[model samples]
Every structure is written in C-alpha cells, then in structure tokens.
Target chain A: MFETLSNVFTDNPLIVSFAIIGITMYIAYKLSDKLTRGRIHGSAIAIILGLVLAYLGGVLTGGEKGLSDISIFAGIGLMGGGMLRDFAIVATAFGASFDEIKKAGMSGVSALFIGVLLSYVVGVAVALSFGYTDAVSLTTIGGGTATYIVGPVTGAAIGASSEVITISIAAGLVKSILTMIGTPFVAKYIGLNNPRSAMVYGGLMGTTSGVAGGLAATDPKLVPYGAVTATFYTGLGCLMVPSVLFLMTRAIFG
Target chain B: MVIFGVALLAICMLIGIFFGEILGLFLGVEANVGGVGIAMIMLVLIVDYLKKRGKLSLPAQDGLGFWSAMYIPIVIAMSANQNVAGALDGGPLAIMAGVAAALIGWLFVPLLSKGGLQTEETVEENTFIGGENKNVRNIK
Candidate 1:
C-alpha cells in the first residue's frame, strides 16, 4: 500500500515510521491496560480520521502541477488538524449537557476553560523561549489542547522561527511530561476545585467527549464533524480563486 | 500513522518553504500555517458529515486522529532537519530540546497557577489526632 513511500525514505522511511508508531502505540496501549485496571482508552475514531486525511492529501497534492494548483490547499488540511481537534474540544465543552460534562470530568465550562488557559500560556511561553514563534502546529489539540484551540497556523505564527516548525511541538512535549513528572501540579490544577477539571482520554476521549456532549444535548453526532468540514473549506480560502486563474493561463498558452 | 503524518508534513513544509514565501507575499496572507489549520478542520467536518449522511467521506479525514499523534515525532525530527539526519542523528537533540521545554512548563505552570488552592472545593482539616480533627485550623 505504501510502496511509493518506501522509495522516499531510507528503504521507505515514511511507511516504516507509520508502522513503528502504530505498533508502539498498540503495545503501549496494551501494556498500559495490563499495568492498570480497565481504564485503558481505545482510539477508533481518531485512527479513522488520521488515515482519511493521509490518503486524500497524498492523492490531491500529487496531481497538482502549476503554482495555481487547487491541491495546495489540500496539503494545508494535513498540518491543521490541531486546530480542528480543538474545535472538537470546544464543541464538546459547550454542546455537552451538565450531566455529560460532569461525566467527562468537567463540573462546568470553567474547568475546561482552566485546562485551555494553562495550555495556551504554556504553548506561548515555550515558543518565545525557543525563538520558534512561527513554527507551531496543533493537529491533536485536546489532551494538551493549547495550539489546537488557537488553531495550528495561529500557534505556528505565535511560535514559528527560522529555526523550527513545531512550536506546539514544544507545547506537546511539556504536556506529556506534566502528566507524569508534574503530576502533583497537574493534579492540583486539573483536579482542584473540581476533580473533573479535565479529562485526559486522548483522541478517543476527544471523540467520546464530543459524542457524549452532543448526545446529552440531543444534537446530531455529525456536528463535531461539521467543524472539520468548515475548517477545511476555510483553509482553502486563498487557494480556490488562484488555481483557476493559473489553470486558465496554462490552457490558453499551451 | 505518525510516519505518514510526518512524511506528509515534511513534504508540505519543504514545498511550502520553497513557495510559501512567494505565495505569502503575493497573496497578502500570513504564512501558509493558517491554511493548514483551516484545512484540518474542514477535512474532519467533511468526513464526519458525509459518513453519517450516507455520502462519501473524504479519504483524508478518515482515521486522522491516529496519525495526529505522530505529530510529536515529526516535531522532534523536523527540529533537527537542518542538522541533517544520518544514522543516530536527531535522537539526543530532540530529547534535549523536549526536556528543556518541559522544565520550563513544569517550573512556570505552578507560578502561573498561583494560589490555586484558594479554589479548593472543600476546606482543609487543621488537625487529625485526638479531638483535634478540626476542619478549620486556628492559629493564635
């Protein structure tokens, strides 16, 4: 399936990278389950979403040629998932009923707000210190959800530099570590006032959060999906008009 | 999944860097970073809506969450692209960069949170032994 990817990296680095991540996450997920009670999380929805984006990006980008190709916008969709993920976070927070929000570990929107607030500050500070003010992206926004809420480009613009591209990458690393080393602090912040200040379920949690929230509100499950659709549509903002211009030019000249 | 994420990202960024500057100037747009952000949201929405409605879901948005996690590695790897990736190349550097960033988060988060204990849901117990089980501690 990824033979083309094989030619690109050292004996197909990209395919190997994906295989490694999938296998590792699977093992980690399994090991975590074994080590603890049945508190393990499954990522059915997120995995489904990731694969769809990948295939389409590969297809659309490859077909485009001129400076005005429509597929350039498609490429943007891949990097911008962080922001889309946050929209999911926001929808779940606002859309969820009082009961559902409680189930998800938020007494109300305030707790969710605290999490987002902390993430945003941490995200920005890391970017400034590293001089990567323009290098961030937020593909999966909720767990640490900083750049995700702000949107990927916004994160990157906040953190980008001539130096790096994952300004939120700095944010992500900090978030993962906090779940471990800074457990006391996180426990205090995320757990204080309300024990359910934030839920750390990951991508699947993101799905569940949205689903549960919508279910509580009696909204369609499709609403969360709508955010992604709007983001991509807007993401294509500049690309749409120009590609036609370029296409017409080529057609006339050739 | 992240492998694809990283690979796709690397491809786009590399391409964008070459053309992003030109495109940015011409379009009067910010860096194309915003474009990518907008795109992911659109991809997810289109994919979810189509599937539930019995229409075709975009292949791109399907299963994207799994791949999104790979973003960590991509960030780490790309951080070192300029140093070049040979055997045993970016492993240590990424770790160092990550650790440094984390230390700041750990140190600063507490300071930023400042006296969040005020937000405690319940009062603290002053004493725990012998008839001194007071929920409120009085210091005189």
Candidate 2:
C-alpha cells in the first residue's frame, strides 16, 4: 500500500507538489495561530518551511534546483516559477482603487524613492564592508536590500556573478524576516494606525510581505493601505535598481 | 461572471507582457520589464472604469477581489522561495549581507518613525497609530 502510494505521487508530480504546498500552508497557519498567536502571518511561516524543504531537497538530491532536482518533487519548480510569480503580482493589483491611491499624495510617492534609496545605500555599504569591490557585486547586493526581487533582477540584468546575486537575495530575505518580526512591536510607537500612515510606512518599508504581515498583526484594517504602496515600492525598485542605480555603482566602483 | 473577469485579466496580462518585452528589448535587458506591474495598472484602471460605468455588478467585483486576494498570498510565497538554495551555498559573505541588512533596517525604523510621531498634533486626521480609535473602522 505504501509503495503504491509513493509510486502514485512519483508518477504525478504536480499533484504531489500541490499536496506538499497545501500541507505546508495548513501547518504554517496552525503554527501561526497556536504558537505565535497570529502575530506572524501563516504565509511567512510557509515560506520559511518551503526554504527548509528546498534545502533538504538540495541535500537529498545533491542538485542545484533544490526539490525540483528530485524526480518526484519536480513539479515544485514549475509551480513556483517566474510565470506564476508575475501572474500573482498582476492579480494582486486588481484590488487597488485609484481614489484610495490618490489619497496618499506626494508623501507616499516620495516614501517609495526614499525607501529604495536608503536600503540600496545600506546594502552597498554592507557589500563593501564584506570586501566586495566590483560594481556588479555591489549593485546587485544593494538592489537586494531594496527587495529580493530587485536584487536578482538587477544582477541578471548587469551580468553579476551568481554568488553575488545569491548574497543579494540573502540580504533581502533578512530584511523581510526582520520587518515581519519587528513591525508589530514598534507599530504603537510609530503611529502606524491610520491609512495615510500605513501607506507611507509601506512606501518606506518596501517589502510587500513584511509590511503586509507586520501591519496585519498591528491592524488588519491597515493591511490594504500598506500593501498598495509596498507594491509600488517593488515596482519602483525594479525600475531603478538595474538602470540608474547600477550605472551609479559602476561609475563609483569602476 | 468569473469567466469575464478572468478574460479581462488575461487581456491586461497579454498587453502588459507585450509592452514589457518591448521595454526589455529597448533597454537591452534579457528579462521581462515590469510586465506584472503594467498588467496590474491596466487591471486597476479597467476595473475602476467598469465600476463607475455600471458595467460591473457587485458579485463580479467581489469575484475579482477574491481572486486578487487569493493570488497575493501565493505570490508572496513564490517570491520568498526564489534562490534560497543559491544563497545558502554562497558562503559567509552572503550570510553577512543578510544579517547586516536586517540589523540596519531595524535600527533605521526609529529615525523613519520620528517624522511620523512628531506630527501627532495634526487635527485633520484624528486617528493615531498605537491605540484603537473609532475612525479606524472607517478605512477600507
């Protein structure tokens, strides 16, 4: 019976992939509700678990594609590939209304630029401190600070080393985790209860998941507002990091 | 109704992807140029227009909303999972970069919040950050 079930999953990898993700999400949500008292979002927990599984997959398969390297878990790669990623991002934008966005005004717009620039500079500084002197390495890492997506996108655009690109991604992930854990603790002190404030905070924070999760814990009502601007932040980072920021880094380091 | 909304989404995504490809070609980049962002803007504008023109019913709007919300968590998870294997093997510099970025970002929060908290005297928006106010319920 066990062999037959295992063979079934191996034959139909996509179904197994869905089952794994579904189970992971269920457990993550349960953990969030019970262990974290819903302070941490289930999505965050699921991502961490996914990463762990990916790591284990790499160890088990001795391959670079993580779980997808294993024949039975090959479907995970397609499910989490770039096409669905872009689709999901576009879909999320459907809920945003123009009038609500207009309410944020100049302050919110400026926050996006400020947030991207601040994180980029900090990322560059860190890269330099770690003894990286190349323009591609510095810019890619700096872009990662803007957001994980930005980091890899910038690296691929500018032909950065894979190692540098990975480091940049790591930087972005660290930022995301910190943002997730820290937002609720500091929400009160920052006056993050209002829509306008949430918008501004989202712009400044930039990581959609972190800002959204943090705000969800702080105030469910504020999640939409923060998410809107954080979405903008990601788009803006993608735009600037590879072109203008990469040029600046090249000029300075080269 | 769901099919119509999905069709609209598909149209927007197609146009956005086309435009992104053009943008990427023009910029000499090898990847898609913000196709998702473009598609999102197109969807937003289209949906809002439909809403104002009375072309969209409440149920359809709700359906669109449901898909968007459902898609978001999935998107978040997918993006978070990207490149973790590479990062883990990138050695100590990668780990250091990650740690430094998080630490600095956390520390910088105070300075960013200073601008927000200092202006609490504004009478226009009565809602404060920390404590619950009745007005909080008014936000969508």
Candidate 3:
C-alpha cells in the first residue's frame, strides 16, 4: 500500500508539488503571525525557506534544478518554470486601480529611468573593483544589478559568458532578497505609505518580485502600484541595458 | 464561473508572451522580454473594463481574487528554482554588486518622494479604501 501510494504521487508530480507548496505556505504564514507578529510577511519567510531548500537540494542531489532533481519533487521544476511565473505576475495586476496608477504621474515615470541608470552605474563600479575590465562582463554584471531578469537578458544579447551570466543572476537574487527583507523596516521612514510613493519605490527597486513581496509586507494595498512600475522598470531595463548601457560600457572600458 | 477568470488570465498571458517574444526578436535577443509585464497590463485593462461595464460578475472577481492572493506562493516557488548556491559559490563580487545596487536604490527613495504629486486629501481618502479593506483581507 505504501509503495503504491508513493508511486501514485510520483506519477502525478504536479499535484504533489502543489500540496508541498501549500503546506509550506501555511507554516510560513503561521510563523509570520506568531513569531514575527506579522512585522515580516509570510512570503518573505517562505522565500528564505525556499532558498534553503534549493541549497539543500543542490547539495543532496549534486544536481541542477534544485529540488526537482529528486524524482518525487520533479514537478517543482515545472511549477516554478517561467510560464507559471509569468502567469502569476500577470494575474497580480487585476487588483490595481487606474486612478491610483495615474496619480503616480511624472515622478513615477522619472523613477524608472533613474532606478535603471543608478543600478547600472553601481553594478559597473562593483564589477570594475572586482578587476573585470572587459565591457561585456561589466555590462552583464551591471545589468544584473538592475534585476535578475535584466541581467540574463542583457548578457545573452551582448554575448556574455555563462559564468558571467550566472554571477549576474546571483547579484540580482541578492538584491531581490534585500528588497524583500528591507522594505517593511524602511516603510515608515521613506514614506512608502501612499500609492504614489509606492510607485516611486517600485520604479526605484525595478525587481518585480522584490518590490511585490516587499510592498506586500509593508502594506498589501501598495503591491499593485509598486508592481506596475516595477514591471515597467524591467521592460525599460531590457531595452536599455543591451544597447545603450552596453555601448556606454564599451566606450568607457575600451 | 471560477474558470472564467482563469481562462481570461490564460488568454491575456498568451497574448502578452507573444508580444514579448516579438519585442525580443526586434531587439535581437533570443529570450522573451517583458512578457509577464505585458500580460499584467492586459489583465488590468480587461478587468477594469469589465468592472466599468458590469460585465464582471461576482464569480469572476472571486476567481481573480484567488489568483491575486496566490501571487506570493507563486513568487516563492519561482525563487526556489533559482540557483542561489551556485551564484554564491561563483564569487563574492556578485554579492557586493547586488548589495551596493539595492542600498543605493533605497537611499534615493526619500529624494524621489519629495518631488512627486502632492495630494494629501487623496492620500487620506485612499488610505481607507486601499489600506484597510478588500485587497488586504486575502493577504493576511
């Protein structure tokens, strides 16, 4: 009976994957409510937990694809694939109000450009300090500072090496985690209380998941405004990093 | 009825991904660019239009509500799939670059907030509707 049940679950990995995620979410929420008194959102905790699991999965299986390396958890790879990720992100916009978005106005628009440029400059400076003199490596790493998505997209467009692309992704992931954990703590100080400020914050952050998760922790209502601008930021970064940013980096470094 | 919302979302996602691929091609990149963002824009437009016309019934709203709340879980799952360990093992430069970027970006928030539109009354009005009521209930 046990073997049959195990086989059944493995056979229907997607269902098991959902069940596992659901249980993890429940525990994470409880931990947030009881342990942190809701100062930290459950999503933040869940992300940390997921990262830990990913690390452990890498170690235990000595394989890529994290937990999906295990046969029983194979469905996790699909569950976490870009298709579902995009679907979930798109679905979040259903809650945003046009009135609120318009209220963000010119400040919101400017924030997007400043955010991308600022991240790129900082990324390039760091890459230089690390002794990477080539424009391709510098541009890829710099773009990663904008967002993980932007990093790979930029790297691929400009013909960056796989190692550089991986490093860029790591940089973006760290930024996302920082944004998620830091938003609630700084919410009050930065006046992230209103939709306009939220939009500005999102534009500055530029990482959609980071901004969304962080704003969710700060105030659920702020998520849509922040998410909308952050989404735009990614699009802007993709357009700018490979062409304009790459050329600028090449000119400076070469 | 519940499926209607998901169906709409699926349709929007398909359209968005298609456009994203086209944009990527135009830019000479091989990856999908801003597909998720485009899909989101479409969903928001469609939902708002439906609401304005009373075409969105309670069931459809409920369907969207379910997925809206599911955002966090999905995000968590997506992050789980990323190879954080590999990145860390690659080098400290990645960490340094990321931290500097995030910190500087955050430091600029106050400056950006200073110049935006000033609507004290609107902020107060929205606090009631946006902060406390419908959207937040499902989150906690």
* Candidate that scores best on DockQ: 3
Q: Which ten residues in a row have the lowest lDDT in candidate 3 chain B?
A: B124-133
- Once fitted onto the true fold, the runs of candidate 3 whose alpha carbons sit more than 4 angstroms away are A1-3, B29-33, B115-140
Docking class of 1: incorrect
Better of 1 and 2 by TM-score: 2
Candidate 3 lDDT tens digits, B21-140: 898788765556667767877787788788778887777777777777666676667656656566566579988988888889888988997844465346445432211246444455
DockQ of 1: 0.05
Q: Compute each candidate's TM-score over C-alphas.
A: 0.30, 0.73, 0.87
lDDT (Cα, tens digit) per residue for candidate 2, span B21-138: 7876776655455555567668777876876688876556555555455443443344334455655665666666655655555455445544444443432342221122332222
For candidate 1, write residues A37-97 as lDDT tens digits. 4232222222222323333433444321111122323223322233333333222211112
Query: Residue by residue across A1-254, what tens digits does model 2's lDDT show?
Result: 98897789788876777677778778977998899887666665666676577667767766655567777677676666656545654555554554545655466677778888888988898789888899988999998887888899888888998877877877786676557656766776667755567777877878876775566446545565566667667667878888898888889999
- TM-score of each candidate's B chain against the true B chain: 0.32, 0.65, 0.78
Give the B-chain TM-score of model 2. Answer: 0.65
Tell me which of candidates 2 and 3 scores higher on lDDT: 3
What DockQ values do the models have? 0.05, 0.26, 0.51
For each candidate, C-alpha RMSD in Å? Answer: 18.1, 6.1, 3.2
